[model samples]
Target: MSALPASRDDASPLSARAGLRVALPIVVLIAAIVAWDLVVRLNQIPPYVLPGPLLVASTLIQDWPVLFGSLLTTLWTTLEGFVAAAVGGIALALLFNQSRLLEYSLFPYAVVLQVTPVIAIAPLLLIYLPQETAVIVCAWIVAFFPVLSNTTLGLNSVDRNLTGLFRLYGASRWQTLLRLKLPAALPYILGGLRIAGGLSLIGAVVAEIAAGSAGAGSGLAYRIAESGYRLNIPRMFAALLLLSTAGIVIYLLLALLSHLLLRRWHESALGKDN
Candidate 1:
């Protein structure tokens, strides 16, 4: 009889664990897909109006070559823009960190660039610049601000006690920045990178939309627009799915990188079990 209550207690936690481990997520995912499929099928939605997952998958397989090629192009453009933003933004942040006068003088301009809608400026950029250059520039502009802003904040937010200690130790300005400030700011920098990665993808797509087709350098966004123009709804949805997947992958990658880099020392990186 005593063993019965003990077994029940043990079984309760195991049952809850099993639900969390397997049942809950599977149920939620199935429910979502079922609801989506039902809404599409039961509502008599035309494929053009809202292609079902099956139709989208069929489209993906059928147009694999075209869709994959466009995916590669968009990925390349996003990476290029993100790389440029990382280098330029970090440099600018460092410069601003070193000079309050310059920060005050130039920050408003950065804010203006950040606040200005890429859609508004993309057309002008396309008109004024070569096609490939315009797309890259527009993407760079869209992604640059987050890294700049986050890194600057991080650099400025070094612990006051640590700063005082470093100063007391006769650490020079450059030494303090390199040994203390930059390390302290890394988490913030990584956070900015996550934001910039998504923005880079958006910027590349938006720039392509504004620039339209110019020779063979078009990305996924161009394919999306072209597909829509030709009423290739399934293909459009397929391209959209690829874009969404890419964005998710990029975010996961950055999160993984952040965790790996910070896991040893940072509280944010610690797993809940720890």
Candidate 2:
């Protein structure tokens, strides 16, 4: 009887906390929107200066066709960059894992790429490369280091005992890498991919903004810049809303993929229920 009550009590609190986690953000968002509406109305803020949320929403609906097209362009660039980053980073990390000499020589350059701001690099890329290629390159630059570093760390972090056991069994280097290191490093690789997904989007946006000045692109970031020049405040906010939604969607999709892939074996995915 006591055990039954204790279980019920524990489960009830966990459920309530889970509900609160979901509800609280929604409540806060609604309250913030209300406050924004009231402030705008009371202050008589001109729509040109700061259009209310409702106007932004209406503008989004009104401009859906154009905004959607630009969004697609940006998404395409982000996708290209993300794929490139994932492939190159993982491949280089694998190479580094195999060769200490390569790791020593190339790791510093990877660090330099990461430390150097993509925004500064974008203008030069735009000058030398086509606008689309430049935008994708910028996204790749911003995203590549995270995957390389994380994967390198993961590969190097294999348990010494397990490694010794493999060696004891006379496992070939390829067999040990394929059977042991890759599986051990999966969580770290997923974490890096999650980070890279958002960063690729950001890199594309930055590059598009740099490209916008020359009237060269139709990406969402370019739309935002165009709206700014025209003082179409509602349109700017609407474009921003769409861009933010895209980013959130990208992050959620990657997180869901991570959870799905890791749920069966990984602690990080397994602990969610508790």
Candidate 3:
């Protein structure tokens, strides 16, 4: 026989790896669901106490309208907070990079905000600000520090030789910042944003839970709290599942964006095979 053509899998190890990567998670998830269902059946567990995955799925479908509305509310708040954190953090970081005195004066306050638990701050915020605003502010406070810290690090990490070269070529401060510092910092900034995306959701949830206690809001977290009070465990699980899915989607989207932006040049975005 003449030489055979290479099989698709033989030709593309990366493709095989990618397929395995996706398939493994799906297999694991299916196995987990099957095990959960079996445990519920074998033990005669009540739905209220531990709803099976199937029951939760049905419950999610049944309550889709209400749950989805709450999800949208929570997502909107997350977006607002993430946007605020991105803009404010980057702007502040730029300012800090330019002026050591400004950084010294303001950086401590940023740290204080980051260290203070948003759960503790939520109640006070709810008291002083409108419910929606308080929730968004909490999200912003939780997310802001990572972006500020990361961008600052990236800016400072620009090579000293490159900095000197830019100065040697008579680059203005703005030119150095725009051309050299910002490009060097892009990876760090994107990494910070990936973290911030999930954190913004968490902060919104915490705030929503706080607001829910006062019978105020309609975010998914509030729905979770409401379901708990009613002992509607299936609905609670459904709401939680939605929240988890939302967070995962947000993270994946940011990660994809970062990869798309940096893949041309950044080592972090490159595949191992590359």
Candidate 4:
């Protein structure tokens, strides 16, 4: 008799690969920053024109109070907009899924809103709404479509056989949706949330930039604009770096949340080659 080799369930190889992926990007980022610093120093570029990374870092520290305050304001607006988008998008998608007539009638308007450029609409919104409200609306508008479309697709993506079995059990619409449809649709919905997180930040920034520092416009975007006007290039770079870092953090957090929620059952979130 011959014995077959046994397979193990260890994921250490994939874990190492994941570790490499994270470490490699960090290394590249450090290298790039170093290169940037060297170039600015070698060329003796004026600080007003282009500041080195060290200057930017120092400026970030010196301007921490103002930057942190603005960051908090921007984060609040982002949170508001993201909450609105998530709620409205999911509610509307659910409503549309329940009724074809409503879906056909209102989906086009949603599409129109999605297609219209937020920058073009920001001025008009400013004319009508309060500055903060307009900024929030802009963020909401940009973040809304992905959630709606993805949820709609997910709700419709249920297996027909499973749906039939649910029906065979005489399951009510709500029961089927809550138990079968939503659970199946979770991955798509999480993906939409991840996309929406970044879009919401961008939308807030665009609105803030367009609005300018008129009143108490305290946001990283406004700071960037103000710094640009004053020719404080290092501060501008610092604010920009903060904005980029915020966006990346939002995306990573959302991705981690999605991975945690879906890792057990969903193929997409399962470890590579698992």
* TM-score preference between candidates 2 and 4, better one: 2
lDDT of the candidates, in the order given: 0.89, 0.93, 0.95, 0.92
The residue pairs in collision within model 1 are: none
Tell me the RMSD of model 4 versus the true structure: 4.8
Which residue pairs show collisions in model 3? none
Summarize candidate 2's per-residue lDDT along 1-274 as a digit string, tens digits: 2323344544775666667789989999999999999989999999999999899999999999999999999999999999999999999999999999999999999999999999999999999998889999999999999999999999989999999999999999999999999999999999999999999999999999999869479999999999999999999999999999999999999999999999998899976556
Best candidate (score: lDDT): 3
- TM-score of every candidate: 0.88, 0.94, 0.95, 0.93
RMSD of 2: 3.3
Q: Write the per-residue lDDT of candidate 1 for residues 197-246, one digit (tens) a residue.
A: 99999999999888675535558899898889888898998999999999
* Residues 201-264, model 4: lDDT tens digits: 9899989988996746899999999999999999999999999999999999999999899888
lDDT of 3 by residue, 103-206 (tens): 99999999999999999999999999999999999999999899999999999999999999999999999999999999999999999999999999999999
Q: Candidate 3 — which residues are off by over 4 angstroms?
A: 1-11
Return the number of clashes found in candidate 4.
Answer: 0
lDDT of 1 at 15: 56
Better of 2 and 3 by lDDT: 3
